[model samples]
Target: MTRALPSGIGLMPVRRPDDHRPRLDRLSAVPITDLARRFSAATPTSARDLDRLDGDLMLRGFAPVGTGVLRRILSRPSFFWMGKSFRRVDDELIAGHNFFTALGGSRGLPFAATIGPSVVDGRPAVRIDYGDPRLAGPRLTRRLYDELREIEPGLWLGPGFLRIGQRRVTVCWFAVDSSVGYGEVR
Candidate 1:
């Protein structure tokens, strides 16, 4: 059975490498546009899989949604965001927050969200919504939306969007690597 892609983005042509570390490294070196395209080609993951990623302290990698030097700069660690932590809140939704390496320790931020199954860009994905007043901050954080797809055994990728009135603006591209931790980046 062949399904149509949503135009522009297409399936990633290269076969995924066997070793996750090399795969992650190769992905990290690709252009942001390629990352987004690869994400579209990836498989949608379940909340149970995400919950299993808990306690692993997923390593974070990101790229800006735009082109040029700033995009590359932001992708590099400036200590703004470290990684994310996931926990199952119920059968359907998974609760998690961004954990930053700050103040001499891991500082989990209040930019939390609930993860669940959803359709994004015409394909199945796991969504992260920060709309709950109790989970996310009442202001800007509430406008943030994200989604993820599994690219490898323990690697996932997604885009972060900011809701502006009726428009959802793509702000950045992010990845969570469950295969590695804070102390294991090489």
Candidate 2:
């Protein structure tokens, strides 16, 4: 019979020593050689691209774990944008403000212009437009992630844990193509 340790001591019964071994169950399926090969082959120009690709590949390769992490990051309330120009009403609206207005104005038609308050926030809130319709679908998001990965290799990609508002959140970055688009990730 084994003697019980004192209550104050941080000692617990050891069942099987082998049972306590770190399990690599989830990591086992992924071939390290293949991953290393792919990583080595990748020629990302910047961190952003690397991050985007990392997130995409992680999601595709790991499924539930990848997606679960992404959802947590994106769902954070604090990950939103906020401030003034976001709510400013400009009298002389630029052509790029609205494609419809730009086209109509160019055709010598009077177009009404208005400004409304908008919230902008996220992991990298400065670069994203939260209300964009293209960002509404997962497929687009994934595609964006892939494109960014290729274009900006050095950016933070996704499928990783982040501490946000006292909770762990997972976030990802992706790209989208729009007829009325402006600016790059930098």
lDDT per residue (tens digit) for residues 17-38 in model 2: 1111112122224443433333
**Which runs in model 1 stand beyond 4 Å of their true positions?**
1-24, 106-120, 182-186
The lDDT of each candidate is 0.59, 0.22
**lDDT for residue 136 in candidate 2, whole number 0-100:** 30
The global Cα lDDT (0 to 1) of model 1 is 0.59
Worst 10 residues of 2 by lDDT: 80-89
lDDT of 1 at 13: 24
Error of 2 at 1 (Å): 77
Number of colliding residue pairs in model 1: 0
Q: Model 2's lDDT to the true fold?
A: 0.22
In model 1, what lDDT does residue 79 have? 34
Per-residue lDDT, model 2, residue 22, is 16
Give lDDT tens digits, candidate 1, residues 42-138: 8766546656556324444655645656555545544346566665555665556665535433433333333454434566677777665445355
